[model samples]
Target: MKLTSYWLDTVPRFTGTPQAALPGQADAVIVGGGFSGLSAALRLRQLGASVVVLERDRVIGEASGRNGGHVNNGLAGSFTDACAKLGEDTATRLYKVLNSAVDTVETITRENGIDCDFTRCGKLKVGNRQAHEAALQTDYARLTVAADPEACLLDETQVREELGSDLFSSGLLYPKSARMHMGRFGIGLANAVLHAGGLIFENTPMTGMKRTGNSFEMTTPQGKILAKSVLMATGISRNAPAWFRQRIMPVGSFIVATEPMDEAAMRRIMPGGRNVVTMQNIHNYFRATADHRLIFGGRASFSRSRTTTDITSGNMLLAAMRRTLPELPDVKIDYCWGGDVDMTVDRLPHAGQWNGVFYTMGYSGHGTQMSVYMGQRMAEAMAGMPDTNPLAGRAWQKIPCYGLASHFLPLVGAFYRAKDFVQEMKE
Candidate 1:
């Protein structure tokens, strides 16, 4: 099997702006060229700002192109828990913004004529345990009443009809959720940024940043640049300030894409063509690609993503996939890969100005839509627009002993696995 992202392998490569001398100054300098950076660059240009984006690797080479391809709406964790922790009104607002985030992605795709196979396939949160059936129903009731009227609860018969697997007991359906070809979207957004007046430099990493009165001076290997405003769209950066790094934990998520399956089998497994996520502590999320390939992924491990780790995690995911869906047609794995998720303690995204630098990140694992949405909003906010940030005033606490995440993550993983085992046994 190829050890690369199926999304990136299938789409046309983005040949960014020609290698040239870096501009001396720009109105705004974006520190990362992932979805958030590209989205912000596009919007900033639209707002008549001279924008420059510096990417350490190829555009969209990281988490943006290496995700499960679900542009799902709503909170990544329990909405009920979010309400209790963030207060009902705040949680509801945060949930609604995610719905808006999905719409923003769709709008950008349509407006830019990005043929990324964007589809409102909706999302199905499957419950894997007998107890989860009632819990999911309760979540559905709470979600529909507070945040999403487009959501519905699925009973056992109805859930089974939507899924080919018998493992799921019930489901929560969010019709506003969508999926798209992430590679195509990333390339399209980059092209849109170029089509506008923005400048993007690939293979350029911002190694240093100094606040020069009224402007920030950024140093890269290519050259130095000055910007009146800076947006740290960098997610889980290896070179980020210690303060930023402490609040964000980089967790590895692995995925595997099956060879194109029979259309009949595909329909059987995913009749509704919905993004599927199971209700487990270390749950899996999956969706069928436009070409009928099953793109399955999960937090196979909490370790950082690398070549060896990716292979090990990919094997774990394939095994889990087989167990989760016995009805899946026999097919070889076409692609396997992993990426680091910018996880926060609260499992929510935070965006606002820090000191003098504007930043957005900490999406945890549910960043696909929020990253893009926050990028645009941050750009607009930088352009002196009204604050549309939902996560603006939330205190971002540093992860305790953040430096030792690697040593402890495996233990945490073990504990979660035991918890899941006990839960399954009870069922």
Candidate 2:
């Protein structure tokens, strides 16, 4: 199996602006060329601002292209807990923001004519335990009245109709969830930035940046540039400014894709044709590609993604997939890869201006749609428009003892695994 992202391999590699020179000055300079940066660049240009994007690697080579391909709506964690912690009104508003995020992604793809197979296939959050089934019921009832009226709870019989596996007892369905060809969308977004008079410099890393009067001077190996405004769209970046780095934790998320199976077989495995996420502490999320490849992903380990770590995590995921879906005994695994998630302590996205720099990140794992939506909002705010940022004014604290956090991930992983085991045993 190739240790590379299947999404990135299937689409054309992004070749940035033809012969575009690094300008000495721009109205806005975006750090990181992932979904957030690219979306911001596109909107910035539309607002008549000269924008420049600096990417440490190839465009979309990071978490943007290395995901489970679910443009799902709703909160990343327990909606009931979010309501308690953030207040019901705040939680409802944020949940609607996510619904709007999906709309934003669809709108962008349609307006740009990006043929990325965008589809509103919805999502199913399945539970394996009876306790989990009860929790799903409670959450579904709360959401239908408080935030999402479109959500529905699936009984065990309904769950069996949707999922082929006998593991799931019930599920909660969110009809607004969608999926897309991430690679195609990323490359298309980059091309849109170029066509919109924005400049994208691939393989360019912003090594340093400091304020110069009202403008910010950013340094790179190739050259330096001055920008009146800057956006730190960098997610879990080791090279980011210290203040931003301390607040975000980079957690490893890994995935494996099976070779294209027969369409009939794929349909049998996922008759409902929806994105599936398990209700576990160390959860797994999966979906089938347009070509019938099963892309299954999860927190295989707490360690960061590396050459060796990816292979080990891929193997773990393969084993888990087999246990979950017994029909895949002879299927070949075509791709295995991993990426780091910008996880926050609260598991919510934070976006606003820091000091003088505009910033947005900490999506945890539910970012595919929010990243694009927030990017556009950040762009509008940068252009002197009213701040429609839903996450504005939310306090962002540094992770406790974050300096030594990576050393403790294994312990955290072990604890969660044990907790899952005990919970299962109780049933």
Candidate 2 regions with alpha-carbon error over 4 angstroms: 303-305
Q: For each candidate, what TM-score against the reference?
A: 0.98, 0.98
Per residue, candidate 2 scores C-alpha lDDT tens digits across 274-322 of: 9999988889999999999999999996665364798898889999898
Worst 10 residues of 1 by lDDT: 301-310
Q: Write the residue-wise lDDT of candidate 1 on 1-427 in tens digits.
A: 9999999999999998876578999999999999999999999999999999999998999899999999999988878888889898988998999999999999999999999999999999999787888887778788888888889989878988898888887889989999999999999999999999799999999999999999999999998999999999899898988889999988888899999998999998888789999988888999999889999999785554364787788789889999998888788898999888998888888899887999999989898899999999999988889866767888898888889976788889989989999989988
Specify the highest-TM-score model's number: 2
**Which regions in candidate 1 have their CA more than 4 angstroms from the true location?**
301-307
The top-ranked prediction according to lDDT is 2
